[model samples]
Target: MLIETMSIVRDIPNLNQLSKQRLDWLLAIKQQDFNTLAAMCYQSHVIPYAMIRQLRLPKSNHYEKMLPSYIIQQVNIKNITEKDQVWLLSNFDALVTTQECIIFCEELINTFNKGRTPKLILQLIQDKCLPTQNETYWYSLQEKTKDILKKQFMISSYYELTAISRILSHENTELDLGFEDHERRQIHSRTMFWSNYSSRFNRVRALLPNEIYRYIETKLKRLSPQIECFDQDGNQEQSEVFIFELSNIIVVEFLRGELSETRFFKNTEWNAKRLFDDKRLSSAAIREMSQMEVHDHLSTWQYFCEKLLRQKLQVKPNDNLPYFKGLPPAVNTYDAKIGLPKPAHNFLSERALKLERWVELFWSAEFKTSKYGHQSGLQLKSNLYLSKALIAKQLDNYEEYELFIKKAANQGNPEAMWQLGKSMLLNRKSDAKIRKYGEEWIGKAASFGHVEAVELATRFKLAFIPYKVSSSITNNDETDIKTKNMEQEKAANEGDLDAMYQLGRRSLLKKGDLLSDRLVAERWIAKAAILGHEDALKLAIKFKLPFVKKK
Candidate 1:
């Protein structure tokens, strides 16, 4: 497929935005062909969900159904050599432990790459207590050989990038599983791997010179990313694509020791603060640093890698950081196109238009005034706002975060309320400011029974009663609280045992209701017990309320 003739593939983060049945229509369009995917293979973080959704499309063609498998088979593992195969079968160990072999195998077979016999054999011996264990094998390796092993592990990390590329090809399917449980496990593994190992990222600063890297998290984002080619050019033609452009520039700046600090950390010195502020260096960084220092990701990786990164940034090798050798380079061939040149397309624009329509409806004064008449759709919109807020928060875009979170909170969203309250109180004192802006929102969220919000409210002493305490709750002129009180009293008087029990419990929380007195609470529960409310009977016994004798 020629690059120029190919239609540039705009980003489509999720195909499920439309029903699965529509994938056939997309496949029929023939726009997302092999060559049109403009984003370099590394920036394909948005491909998995698209792949999984395509796999779920019921009317998938023969080509579509078998694509994931076909892509995996493209990598001829047989070229790994007989000796290497025998070593894996006989004694060679992978970066993952024997105990973790099952998890690693699932990761390989179910999602990333599978159908290799050596990998299967390796999995088979995971529980067999091999004579040459992973620890033993690693410890026995020559320093050079150990470096090689580390490199191999790094190679394995790109497996997902390859799979995602095949997905973006829009020409493939998973051999066995698409985005099922095992795929989720792999996502979790990758996230943990990145988060747990970031401190020692300098150990493999070698990889920084490479064309691409994967985004650390974003397992469930609709228009998310996966792979990013840090050196790719001319990708920011559209205003929306600046994110991709800037992310790569950051990588470049970081690698060249030209990394600048964000304004938030301007008060801190670059000498010791850059890596900690990186929100976890990559997990691979930690592992490599640990491998070099003879300690683990959390320990030596933290202690030594910080110094190494600092020295590198400071532009002088002070002595300690100049010596450590990370593991060897990866044996696997990176088949992904490092910098596939192309332009933007309308695929994403079309989706963006659809999203724009929804956004307009959400923000329009007329639409906001008119009932949307759909609870599920409204909830989805609220959640979308919340998700945007979270993504904005990650990027330190306070304006977008505030805008989205406030929109969601105004819709009575508990999560938005919780987040909003947290934001207000995050660094501010528990003074009049919190009471004015933060406490009430947190209280509203807790009143809606959001457990985390409830906890936060309690933790910060921000909680307030949502319902007004009146002389007679059942007759009070407030909103729903009065209606609920009226309904409970009516049902209790009408001998509804469940309602009777609820009224009894409500009486204990406030002394102004129809059943407000403790004596009345006991009476109602006792009556409910006689009327066959088992829970009421239990409550009576537990509280020793007139129906059971005190032991």
Candidate 2:
């Protein structure tokens, strides 16, 4: 019955960027005052059909397959002729309670028998109850009928039923029951016992053996339908002595669940120390210490002692037993090198030449350390350069980007150094810094075999080429002029402070389509501050810039 309704699409903050064409179409409907509402499609940048199709009354012409609006919103839907309602009730289990309330239980049962909508059977079983004839009628019977319903219809022993009762009660209606005095007491005790049993059983499942579930199933079968009761003599009695024998099997199952297959440990935390502190297990230990004898994976003596404790007292587990005492100490016998490291061999090989220096520097020290780790340093510097470079490039301020690149590279940052040299050469300024630092940078980078710098140097006729500029660049006028003026300065005329300031702040604001670079961003911001750009100066003061703030 599942059907795809809407495809996930681009992010749309609101309805603002919905295409003009789509908007115009929707506006036409709005102006006509049709029963239409326009909103962004759930999980899409585009609008869905303008009409609220689900709210439309079902017509012979309407497609049966289209999802109803109420259904899409997961609301309880009851819109149809009585005959149609009865037919639907007979075919779908999701509407079982709705059918029962509407006096169509026979139809619902027929639907269940036909095997249509089998997935909804569990939901129906869990929510089964009396029908809601009228709210006023139920209110009149609140005191009188509440008792009768609690005894007959609300006696389910299942956990899901108990949870559903709490939910139904909040809506202030009864399916078949109200909270009667004895039933209230029964519910309190049942909830307590159920919570306790579930908690311990879950913990046991987490710690126990896989095969032990079979043993438990066999044991549960052997016991009386009623697990515990008192006889006329007021002695706490059991139909079988099997409960006493269950400890070894339960403990085995618990340990297996914790150490092996993970299916049993679902939604439970497994801890050895907290399992020891349980009072029930302590009492059981005192009793079973002399008699029961069974043994398995007690690699640690602590585990053995805890197992023995459980056997002696025949302790019935409760909710609090599994709360952890603390973290277990590392097992000295277990090898730490069981799992393979990440950054696969293929991935490393592909980037080995480009990432050689970064790899060495990043791995030189343990990643997790108390003080400034190399990994932390690299992460911080990489982010910084990327942001600055992006901003400077966006503002067309290549000079500032060059400075930021130098600072990042001097800190052993290959990416930053590569960016700095690349920006200087590309912008065609090629000043002394480009020659002095650029040559040294390209050499250091190529030594480590950084592919990006090598590729650029090989293709461009710059004085600082790590290897020969490619054959294509040697004959080209554009590259030849660049090579000849590889050390030209681009400054302004003397006394023209505005032009001088602009020259100093050339790449302060990047222009055109380029990605953000932190180094470039910082450089532009810094250059503008040096020229007394008010906003830039304030930013410098705020961030406590390394050199300019003091000045």
Candidate 3:
């Protein structure tokens, strides 16, 4: 009855393609009739082979004993698809005896050599099948894999290196071949070690002999004059210092040459042409040579040159070089005594050290302040101090930040003034005198055309109006107040909207009966609103007055 049912379903297109003999084999496999399949295997291997390829057999070990014989007898290695091979390899432990599995793996290796099988099959054989075997078996498979990779490397073209690299660099497990350690070392080597070739070939480079490394170095040196054979010592610290010194010299020379050639420096007023031309200029002269506009350019050039030098020298960038002593030793060393101030040197990173060195070298305050016009000197000094203030802030050195920012502000740096003002104002617990000082600095910054400071000053001015009015009323005698009110009333009667708004605002602050004050304030604001004063109009609306503006 089941056979009859299968026959009905077998008329579908997939089953329709099979011949009657194959159809009978498929039906037998579905029915789990191993005895019939064994009998069918005796007649011809076709039905057994077709069953293995087309049918999804049960994976239980019950059929394990029977399936290996069918597979050995029915399947031909050259005729099966790689998918079929993978499946067979995956279940090879159950499908074949240990000896037969070895033979199957050898066949798969031969298939791989002929480029007919993927490396995954070999990986599966190595990872899944061989690990449980005895030591001899495991070592034998590892040796075979190693030999295959070595032979491939010897003959592999540039394009074929990736395939070999993948086979060697399995993520799940490292292949026991000699290349893994070498690949790792190459991975952690200076990026310049593989600078001659694409980084994609790093694994391949590890496979290269010393002769190839020498050849690459020779070629690199021949191509690039700046590149030197500095890697022999393998002291990365020394190499870093060498490169740093070289880059600094190059930057200094390049900047000097640029300044000497610049037409701006040749002007009679600057008198800087001779200063730039001196080969043995003092450090003071060097700092004087730098202008505010060239600071960014100098930084960019130094970075680019340093990177290029490191790449050429086959050295990695070492941020933690204890050997580098270009600058004087930091005197901020700690003392063990309790209650003494701790030094900030421990908190300064390598970047902060370099920033300090840069400020000391090129941006120091030793320049002639009156040589290149007073304003230019002050502007340059302000920028340099601002740079120092930013670095100090980054290091959380509040004292240094305040000191440098004050210097910059005294030099008329608007940004520094604004920053100082904002910092002072942010300290809400400060006394009124400090607050007023902060507000005065903000006003100064606004006068210097700082945009944010301008907006902030307008808000501060409006917010301080009531305070100013109340303070004046409190400080002045009744005679003085009466005279001020009379002058304000006289100005308001002449249609001065500012005077009208002030009068209205002053009435609202008079500290009397609330109803009378509001009524008096509303009348003055309404009169001002009639004259198209924006603030008076807003105040009138806020008071809920019934006044309309004139067209």
Measured by lDDT, the strongest candidate is: 3
Candidate 3: tens digits of C-alpha lDDT, residues 1-551: 76567776666665443355566665766777666665555444333444545444434445435554444333354566555554555445443455656555554554456554445565654553342222323323434543464354332212222222222333321333333453432222212221212212211111222332344344221212221232332221111100111111112221121121111111111222223233333333433443322222221122322333344333333333332111124521212222113224543554466566666654443344323332456867797798789767756778999999999988988889899988888897878888888888887776665646755776556222221223333333545557768976876777667677778865553345378777877788898888787777876675577898989
Instruction: Write the candidate numbers in order of decreasing TM-score.
Output: 3, 1, 2
* Per-residue alpha-carbon lDDT of candidate 2 for residues 406-513, written as tens digits (9 for 90 to 100): 666766566666766565555566788766666666655543335455544444532342332234433455454454333121222222222333332223222231
Q: Highest TM-score among the candidates is held by which one?
A: 3
Q: Give the TM-score of candidate 3.
A: 0.27
Deviation from native of the Cα of residue 237 in model 1, angstroms: 36
Candidate 2 vs candidate 3: the TM-score winner is 3
Candidate 2 lDDT at 150 equals 34
Question: Could you report the Cα RMSD, in angstroms, for every candidate shown?
Answer: 26.1, 31.7, 24.7
TM-score on alpha carbons, each prediction: 0.25, 0.19, 0.27
Clashing pairs in 3: none
Clashes of each: 20, 48, 0
**Per-residue lDDT tens digits of candidate 1, residues 203-269?**
1111211221232222211212323332333421110000011110111112111111111111112
lDDT of 3 at 89: 51
Clashes of 2: 48
